[model samples]
Target: MLLNNLNNDQGFRNFYMNKRGPIINHLCFDDDVILFSSGNRKSLKRIMRTLKTYEDVSGQLVNKHKSSVILHDKACARRIDRAKRITTMKQECFPINYLGCPLYLGRKRISTFSVTVQKILNKIRGWFFKFLSVGGKSVLIKHVLQAMPSHLLAVMQPPKTVFEIIENAFNRFLWSGSDGNKKLHWSSWDNLSYPINDGGANFRKLADISKAFTTKHWWKLRTKRYLWSLFLNTKYCSRIHPVTNKWRNGQSHNWKAMCSIKVLVENNLGWIIEKGEVAFWYDNWTDLGPLYKFLDPDSKPSKLRITDAYQNGHWNWPACGYVVSDFIKAHIERMQVVLSDKPDLPIWKITSSGKFNIESAWNFLRNSRHESNIVNALCHKAVPFKMSFMAWRVFHRKIPSNDIIISWFKLLASPNCTCCRVSQPENIDHIFFQSYVASSA
Candidate 1:
């Protein structure tokens, strides 16, 4: 019926889409209907008349007062007043929240979402994290504090200042002594963001969290076929299909963030070579990295799919224009290939489950580099969270011994081991091994 009206009514002008023919200027999801028309009195009246006619026939009333007009560009006051008179609706204010997204024209500022910042601070101020054990604090930080700003992060990436404020609150809560006194920081923020077994407390990093959410959006764009994706396809990616086209800068902040994360996803994603969607030379199909990297830098590149390197469902090494190394040959031999009618698919290599998730993304970011094998030894089923945290402190040599405390605050003139009444400084090695009490115990 909407399409019929667009075809028949001369007053109705379809929205001009760049990639395709004009489309109907309306969006209806469930019970909500948002109608779009040109910024003119005639078009507004036509839409109002159409809505009234539909309502009269369907036994429903048009709520004119509840409706609003939101203009992105600056318009003359008289023009806006005329639009208001035509539609009998008020103009919405800028920076209004629509469907949980802040809509405004111009560069994003931290103060654009001041309400979110206050909420985080209020939640932190109410908590008494000092009374809790290290493990307890860890659990609360993961389950409560980290999860607090999740809705905001999903739609809009918060500024660095916002992230820092939240992280500072977490840091103060993590290291508060009795009666709200400050305690010495045992480890750096970067080390604490690692997994528990990696000699630091496992805390959520906002930067990584932001990247993960944006990456999930990219995953949805690739896997889900919907009206929104179709609109994106028509507007930004009409010339080339997403699989083959390089990412471009997006006009919107959300799209730009997704493009940045898409680069990160490219490195961790592997192809499940079915029907040769996987590029032979560029994609990570074989156990080895992209085959193009092995070729001489002077060699010209070509668009080669994985199927090109197969003949009669067997390996065809000569198809590649490079001299195949023995190592590459062995790696190819181990890769099982079964050609079928299915198209190729992508798998997240960081996860054993072959799916994209927040946990897998966090683990990838946390342990991808500088991983310590001591994680295996430090993490045991029998150890409690507090004990494990203490052991981690010991491993990092971060215990607040007398010598370190004195140096950190200049509390004492001497660096003597108080427990043993010795003149030597009290360090990790001395407190744990050299002291008379420690040796006796």
Candidate 2:
């Protein structure tokens, strides 16, 4: 309300967002506020007056010590000193930590996101990973370590180096159970991160997890009704809807992260047609996707609503501008459009309820990557996981057996059955069957 009055008074002007982009005056979340404005003495003094008025009315004082002024490097000396005197706050640099996440301009550096990697390590501090069994360690990594980067990854596209450093920590903890000690990782992460059915250890990769969830943020832009979403739509996605938006230069990193999985979002999205509120030409209301694709470049209908052709529980065939082929008719016939007072909703086709979920997104992204019936056989519920863990290793030939070691290290000594001291290739078959101890048993 105060901002509305200020705009009306014409006392302050917001900073330009991008090249011909929306003017974002401020972004407020919880108790924190991020104000954006053109650097000028008049606007700076106006902001100070507004803050003073807010403190007077609300009885909540603004902390000058906690706040700092930041200006563009090109901001003139007079404007900087005037801004400092008016705002009564010291000037700070880029990459200020606010609300526990770093906010900065331009490209991210190693030190920029290094704080996130340290946060993951902090979660595992004081733990004796060396003593934990394989099963116990797996549980901790999945539940604790893996969850550490989720919030940051959701907010921004994380650096590939950040993912690598964190994954290396997971590998170090899983194999040696200690950061200092060296141990052989019998299987590569690609093999180990696959589901149990695929003969893997069922560890999820952080990169895949991040990619699957990038679409979730885009899903919220259209589906969620919130103040931030309103501003986001006004500021960034006004001219183009998120699903169909092609890339453009000078876009924000947050928007770039959401666009990373544009294909997945477009393909998996389904529309719940109610009152024909969805766009007929652009929305994916049919299995063949948007109806616009079927028409010629010059002939596609403009401003045509689905309700224009829908009547009396059937499609009015002549209402369409283009020829409706038998193939197109078949797809349209299968669509169930319900007329109700409820507003139209976009559905995430990956889930049954038409709602987006992280687990379902992950499952959809990771689906068919691995399929093995051995999941039921190798992992048992009632027994100790130590035994199950060993059985899992043995089944995948991941144990440090002489045969496996010989393949990896190529020891100078010829392979022998270490258990029976037999002069033969120390292979899984010979050690388990042909040895005297196994033959007599």
For model 2, give the 10-residue run with minimal summed lDDT: 367-376
TM-score, structure 2 vs. true: 0.85
Q: Largest TM-score belongs to which candidate?
A: 2
Clashing pairs in 1: none
Candidate 2 colliding pairs: none
Give the candidate number with the greatest lDDT. 2
Q: Candidate 1 lDDT, tens digit per residue, 167-227? A: 8878877777645667777776667886555545667688788777777777777555676
In order of listing, the candidates' clash counts read 0, 0
Instruction: Supply candidate 1's per-residue lDDT for 342.
Output: 93
Model 2, stretches more than 4 Å misplaced? 1-5, 16-24, 122-130, 177-179, 235-237, 297-304, 307-340, 380-384, 421-425, 429-441
Please provide TM-scores, in order, for all candidate models, with all chains considered together: 0.73, 0.85
Cα lDDT tens digits, model 2, 1-441, are 665456555767767545454456667888878777778777877778888899999999989999898998778888888888888899987887777677788887767887878887776564654577778888998888888778777777767888888888888777874554768887667667766556566678887788777777777776776765666776776666555565567767777877777667778887777878666676787867877777886663654568888888898878877777888888788866767777777888877787888888877777455444565476555546667667777667777667788778987766776567557767666756777776888
